[model samples]
Target: MSDPAALLRAYDHQLRDEAETPSAVAVERLGPLRLATFRGGRGFITYSTLDEDGRPATQESVLALVDGALAHYTASPDIHRVEWKTRGHDHAPGLHEALVGHGFVPDEPESVMVGEAALLAVDVELPAGVVVRQVTDEDDVRAMCAMQAEVFGDTPEFAAEILLQVLHRLRTRDDMEMWVAEADGTIVSAGRLEPVAGSEFAGIWGGATLPEWRGKGIYRALTAARARSALRHGKRYINSDSTEFSRPILERSGLVKVSTTTPYEWRRDT
Candidate 1:
């Protein structure tokens, strides 16, 4: 699993496809794409590969597929935003042009980090007064999300919407675990662990730490706590789409950057 090529292969074989859409409210198949609709007017598009009928994708076919996927989400007026997840290693031709031509704006690329969960399960000494633990109560979850929104600089209205969506998921789902690092009753760092059912992978997502808490071991400890939880749930591998700040930490924790993922998003107004 330490080998980058081997890890990337395992990721493509195990973590892609329907396994990526476990929490979708509804899912539809369009060509090779799995178009997912989630709560709060969010739509997601992902696929294992871009091959059509076992043949490599041509520019024309890729454009057609993008249009079809967009049309599929457009038909549902309730979907206010859509994100098409694109992998750097995918055999997609003219994907960037197609997505942009269809009104999708690309986000910053993230490193697709993957490795054994055990590597992240080690104990890390935390800064004085900072404590990391799992959080399940409504109040604690809200605080964690609020701290994350502040760290990420989310707008008030958008932050409220994210809080509602997160609370809804917290109430309705048991597959995800929320963790936080708090000091003197204020949350400083937080993240979520999503153990994929019937797969060996668990996703570490939404990791954010307050600026003042950066450079300390708080985030690493929070990750270790979540990794232990994933191990308890029988997941062997941990995967994350990490931002620049987190990629180096995870790399130090034994994860390899298997590839890069950039999300192309389209808002309803656009």
Candidate 2:
């Protein structure tokens, strides 16, 4: 039997490919790597297994692929921010060095948490006037995106436009769903669940609650709702790119932080 870590890596490789968003724009295949493009001037790159995908492209070859893609995107002035998304569960041999060598700087490794849905589905008591609801309309989705921007310290326009694209996806395909908790008739907490096309795990993303509403267990409740939703779609596990704030909550809910993902950035000047 493969080690538990190996199983986790296999899962990451398959799940990411199946679960990626559609408006993802462009997808470039180099060996087993998937270098994808999305809206928001973003370039995302991921690999199935840095070492075990059976493609086994050499370190130098992988570096060449990164350079080729960077150069391709640099030709267009609109490509300002590129993210080389890495997973901690896989052996990325020389990925860090390669990315840095090509001028990509590493960002934080978010916690990747996954576990059974039953562990997270508990009724949480919000602070008296909060309500949670699923959103299927464009306006509500945009509003939720704007709120998330505020909480994460980003410009409202940046995320709203990005979410507009996501909304189009949600409308055309029913696989994606967004939910938020409303308090005093205003959204206070939110999250989204995306089911992978051919996998057993659904990715839980964009979870946030107002700073004032943090400790009341609203976030946990939001997670439970998403887990139950995932189960409805036949998904057995949930995964997330969690912040430190949400990590402990998820850990308490029985999800294991199997790996860490750090995003590296690069610019024309750098």
- Each prediction's RMSD over C-alphas, in Å, is 1.2, 2.8
TM-score of each: 0.97, 0.89
lDDT of 2 by residue, 93-184 (tens): 67778889989998777987777667787777767887878998778887888788889887665575567678767867777899999988
Residue-level lDDT of model 1, residues 111-227, one tens digit each, is 999999999999999988889989999999989988998988988866887787788877887888999999998999999999988889999999999998899988999999999
State residue 71's C-alpha deviation in candidate 1, in Å.
1.1
Q: Which stretches in model 1 have alpha-carbon errors above 4 Å?
A: none
Question: Best-fitting candidate, measured by TM-score?
Answer: 1
lDDT of residue 164 for candidate 1? 78
Error of 1 at 107 (Å): 0.6
User: How well does candidate 1 match the true structure in TM-score terms?
Assistant: 0.97
Q: What's the lDDT for all of these models?
A: 0.92, 0.77
The CA lDDT at 14 in model 1 is 89
